[model samples]
Target: MNRETLVNALLILGLLAAPFAADAMGEPFYVTLATRIAILALAATGLNIALGLGGLVSFGHAAFFGIGGYAAGILATHAFNAEPLLFGLPGTNQMVSIWLAAVAAAGMAALLIGLISLRTSGVYFIMITLAFAQMIYYFAISWPAYGGEDGLSIYVRNAFPGTNTMRPMSFFLIAAGLLLAGLAFFALLRNSRFGAALQAGRQNEIRLAAVGIAPFRIRLVAFVLSAMMTGVAGALFADLNRFVSPSMLSWHMSGELIVLIILGGVGRLAGPLAGAIVYVLFEFALGGVTEHWQLFLGLVLLCVVLFARGGVVGLLAGRARHG
Candidate 1:
């Protein structure tokens, strides 16, 4: 095990240990906090696929995240009310069903968004994505069926096969498991042929095209896959809060996801997890200290950007070697 591997392993172990330790000490709130870190990390991991590998600076990922949240909220609402979703498709309280719905909905949205946004590059791409996200955000706010601006509430947590998801520990384990799976997927993707092509396009699109590779399709697929992953995280988040609102679709949420990736280590496999841990801890500790905690947070982010370009993981693991 090299330094990077060791650090990554320690980070995951620490995340797992912290929650269990908190639960053992009867500090359920901390378990919830750890779960938030895992969910946010999962969302950031999705963004990392596009941003890190494909070099796509998508500023509208919140659209997918919100879509997933709404999927959960709407599905749970229909199930609670014993109503059928469109076309006689009954609402489901099952976590598997809700996750499938979330992934499908978000994937479709990503397809449309990627088809249009992928045509542009650089700042144009970023702005186009952001614009699309804002459109959805406004739509969510104006649509009153599911509480609109106030957001929709789920009366009960979604059922996850045999597991007592109502228990904080159980839910944390589920979220943690997903996070681990996501990390593993990310690592595999990074080493696969598709990952190679994506990174090649990121480095030199002209060269990739010369080799008969289509950068556009590769990027679009990456974007859609990224959206699907983030969407799943959104479903988990809604279950954690038992609420879904337009706020989930806001640009701020998108920005925060990017921040999580950057803070952890932009292209590093464990970047999202590292960043989420630091971010959540900062939020918890600073909020308790002062209401104007954002000011301090901004300063810390500035330092990371200027001095710790590699993020927390980068700082610990050394700069990654590019081929």
Candidate 2:
């Protein structure tokens, strides 16, 4: 394998090994840290599909992320209380079921948001998406049914078939598996005909339209799919913290997802994972030194944007060799 592929493999293996080693060394908190990286990477991967591939710089992805968290929280709450959800549907603490609900809820929200937001482009699109996210964030805060600003808490972690998710290692593995799956999906999409069309639309929508491709439809589908993936991450995230809140839907969360993608390598398949690793490391290492560590973080991000245009992955992998 070439350097890029080797680096990618090593990154995944390192992530896997680090947690196991941490667990063996009696540092379960590190395992949780690794799990957070996996979940955040997965969420950023979803954003990459739209921002990296389709050139859709959506600024409201937190809406979907929050939706996923709420889906898990609401479902688990009802299950814990032995209550039925809307339409007489019973609640479940099953991870599989909760994931499905998260996907569906986020997908529907993306569809509605995209239907209107996609009608515009450039700054308009960005602002519209951000507006939608803010609306959802406010609604979540005002909605008193689910604890409002205080957020909803899950007393126990959700169950996964054939696995004791309560164990940090087990949960980390689950998150890792999903992260790998998302990476694989991203790679496949980046190479497929649809992927080509999506990129072409990004480069020149008029040309793609001349070739009989509907950029609108392609982007809309991509947006919904992206939301679904991020939603799954949100569900996993809620389970990780055993809580759900409006904070998940905030514009800041959306911006962070975009920052992860950019920091990793905007269009690179493994960018999200790489970025998450760097981001979490920065947060952990810097937070211990100063409370205003974000100022330093911002400086680092500025350096990345100004000099390391391709992100950490791009820098390590070198520029893509085009024939």
Candidate 3:
């Protein structure tokens, strides 16, 4: 196998193994930590489709992330209370149904956001996307139905068919399995005709336009797909923590997703996973030792930007080989 493939395999296996090993050692905390890595990595993978593949640096992705979280929280809350939704629709504690709702809600929001944001480029695009995110963030804060700024909480994990999601390993497996599926989609999308068009537009919009391909359309579709992926992660995250809040919509969360991509190796299929691993481990290990842990995290990020521009996967597997 190629080095990149091997490295990718190792990364996936390492992630799956960490929690199992932790469970063996009676370290449920570490297993939970691994789940966080998986969910966050999946979110970043979504961002990578826009930022890395389509070359659209979106700063408001957290908007979709939060929307997905709220989808889960709101649905579960209604189900628990046995209340009907706005349309007299019954709330569901089913994970499958919740995921579909999250995807549909986030995708619709993305369609709206993309229609507006894709009109601008460079700094304007960045600012407008960030503006959209902040608008949602404030709306969440002011909207009292779901606990306003205090956030919404799910008293119990949602049901996932036959699996007992309350079990740490079961939940981790669910997250990890979704992450694997996301990665597979990434691979397939990257090698597809649509992916070629997206990347080509990123490289040269005028050329793509001359070839009768619309960059705007390609990007809008990609942006929507990206949002859907991240939205699923948000659902899983809410389930993981049993809580959803306005905090998920914060600009900081968006930036964290970007950092994960940069740390893992932007555009590389396994980059997000690698980035999430390092980022979470750093946070977990350093947070316990120092109050100013962010200072060190910043330093590490600086090093990555300055010295290892290709990121962790780049360092281990060398530059990615595009075929």
Candidate 4:
């Protein structure tokens, strides 16, 4: 097999392996960290679809991410309190329901945001997206009904079919499975006709337009799809932490997701996983020593940008072959 393909295979296997090893070693904390890497990788993978494949650099993706978190938090809270949600809808503590709600909420928000923001390009696009995210962040902070700045907490981990989600191993498997699915989707999308048009529009919008394809629609769809994936990750993330807060919607969160894409290798399918693995491990390894660990991380990012433009996976796999 080719290097890129082999690297992709090993990355997936390694992600699952680490969690299993951690569980075996009685280091459940490490399993949680591995799960965090998988969730962040999934979130960044969503962003890569728009940023890497479509060249749509979104600076406000955290809006969708936060929305997903809130979806889980709200549903679980209501279920725990034995209260019905709006419109007399019953609250659910099931992961299946929470995930569906997260996807729906993020998808709707993405649609509305894309309708307006996709009209602009370049810095305007980035700023508008960032502005939307900040607006959401402020809204969450002011909405005291859900504890405002204190955030909402999930009293219990949501249930999944026949799985004990409270177990670190089980939860890690769910996150890793989703991460794998996201990667598979990325591989398929990158090879499809739609993906070709999306990439073409990124290269030359005028030519793409001349070919009777509307770049805006394709981008909008991609943005919404991307949001859905990230939303799911957010739901999983909230469950992992057992809380949802405005911080998830903050511009800093958006920036971090972008940083992950850059660190991993942008468009490469396994790049987000590689980036997440490195980023999380670095944080775990150095966070206790200094509060300014980010400074060091920034230097590493500079090296990646200057020396390894394709990202971590790119460094190991040579270069992407879009076949």
Candidate 5:
């Protein structure tokens, strides 16, 4: 196999082996860590579709992520209370249902946000998105139903078909499956005609316009799809934590998502995955080594930005044109 194929193969093998090894070692914490990697990676993959492919530097993606988390939390709480969701709609605790709702909510929000943001470009676009996210964050904090400033908690982990999701390994596998599916989607999109247009629009919008293609529409579509994917990750994350709050909608969450992309190498398909892996590892390792771990993380992030350039993926795969 070529280098890329060989690297991917090894990575997949390592991820597949992680759960079993963690179980054998009688250490469930690592399983949770691995799950966090997968879920965050999935979220980053969604952002990559827009930031990497469409060159849309959205700063409000956390809105979608928070929406997804709220969807999961709200549904679980209502189901636990045996209350109706809305218009007498019965609340459900199924993971699939929660994910679907999260995706829908995020997609809808993206559509609205993209319509207005796409009218502007560059700094204006970034600031607009950030403003929208802040609005959502403040709203979540003010609203009391789903725990406003306080977060909503799930007493029991939600169930999935044919699996005891409460089990660490089982849930990890579920997250892994979602991650694999997301990767497949990314590959498919990257190779498709729309992907070509989106990438082209990013590289040379004027040329694309010369060819009679509207960069605005293409980017808007990409932005919405990106939000939807991140939304799914948010749903999974809420399930993982069994809690949801305004914190998920905050600007810090948006910054963290961007950090994942930049640290991994922007635009690379596996960049987010690699970044999530390294980021979590840093958090875990540094947390153990020092009380002021965040200070070290900031230092490391600065190094990555200045020295690494393309990110971990670029370091591994050679510099790509974008990322």
Candidate 6:
């Protein structure tokens, strides 16, 4: 196998072994840490679809991410209290239902946002997306129906079929499975004809259009898919934290998503995954060392932006030789 293949294999094996290793070592905290990294990586992977593949630098993905968290929170809350949703639909705590809701909500939101945002490019595109996310963030804060700024708690994590999800290791496996499926989709998309067109548009929109391809349509499709994936991650994040709040939709959250992509190595398949691991590790480590951990994170990010272009993957693998 080539270097990339070997790296992918090692990554998969490491993630698979992490929970068992932690359990055997009597260090449940590291298991939880690994789980958080996987989930964050999954979310960053979604952003990578648009930014890395399609070259659409969206600063509003946290809008969809928050939407997914809210979906899980709302349903779980009603189900916990034996309440019914609008139209008399009984609320459910089932994981499948939450996933569906997360995808649909994000897709619809993306459809609407993409329609308008596709008209612009460069700085306008970035600012427009950021504005939209901020709008959602403020809406969440102002609207008090589902606890609004206060947020809502999931007293019990929503259920999955045939598994004791409450167990950290068991839930970690479920998250790992979802992440692998997402990675498969990413690989498939990157190899498809449409992916080729999207990348072409990213590199040169005029040239792509000269070849009879519409950049707007391709990007919009990519944007929607990216949002859907981020939304799925948001749902998992809500379960992990046992709460959902407007903070998830904030502009800062969107910035962090972008930071993860850039920090890992833009356009590389493993960029976001590696970045998330580093980011979570930094957060965990820095939090233990200082109360103002974010200050240190900002400094580290500044250093990365100035000195390191390829992030951890770039540092480890050198330049990518493959297309």
- Each prediction's TM-score versus the true structure: 0.99, 0.98, 0.99, 0.98, 0.97, 0.96
Per-residue lDDT of 1-323 in model 2, one digit per residue for the tens? 88788778988999999999999999999999999999999999999999989999999999999999999999999999999999999999999999999999999999999999999999999999999999999999999999899999999999999999999999999999999999999889978988899988988999999999999999999999999999999999999999999999999999999889888988788888999998898889999999888888788889999999889888999875422
Least accurate 10 contiguous residues by lDDT in model 1: 314-323
For 1-323, candidate 3 gives per-residue lDDT tens digits of: 88899999999999999999999999999999999999999999999999999999999999999999999999999999999998899999999999999999999999999999999999999999999999999999999999999999999999998889999999999999999999999999999999999999888999999999989999999999999999999999999999999999999999999999999999999999999999999999998999788788888889999999889999999987666
Candidate 5 lDDT over 102-121, as tens digits, reads: 99999999999999998998
lDDT of 4: 0.92
Candidate closer to the true structure by TM-score (higher is better), 3 or 6: 3
- lDDT by residue (27-115, candidate 4, tens digit) is 99999999999999999999999999999999999999999999999999999998989999988999988999999999999999999
Question: What are the per-residue Cα lDDT tens digits for candidate 6 across 20-82?
Answer: 999898888887888888888888899998999888999999999999999999999889999
| Candidate 4 residue pairs that clash | none
Ranking by lDDT: 3, 1, 2, 4, 5, 6
- Pick the winner on lDDT between candidates 4 and 5: 4
Worst 10 residues of 6 by lDDT: 314-323
Pick the winner on TM-score between candidates 1 and 5: 1
Off by over 4 Å in 5: 321-323
Give the alpha-carbon lDDT of every model.
Answer: 0.95, 0.94, 0.95, 0.92, 0.89, 0.88
Q: Extract clashing residue pairs from model 1.
A: none
Error of 3 at 233 (Å): 0.3
Per-residue lDDT tens digits for candidate 1, residues 1-323, read: 78999999999999999988999999999999999999999999999999988999999999999999999999999999999989998999999899999999999999999999999999999999999999999999999988999999999999999899999999999999999999999999989999999999999999999999999999999999999999999999999999999999999999999999899998789999999999999999999999888788788789999999999999999998664
Model 1 segments beyond 4 Å from truth?
none
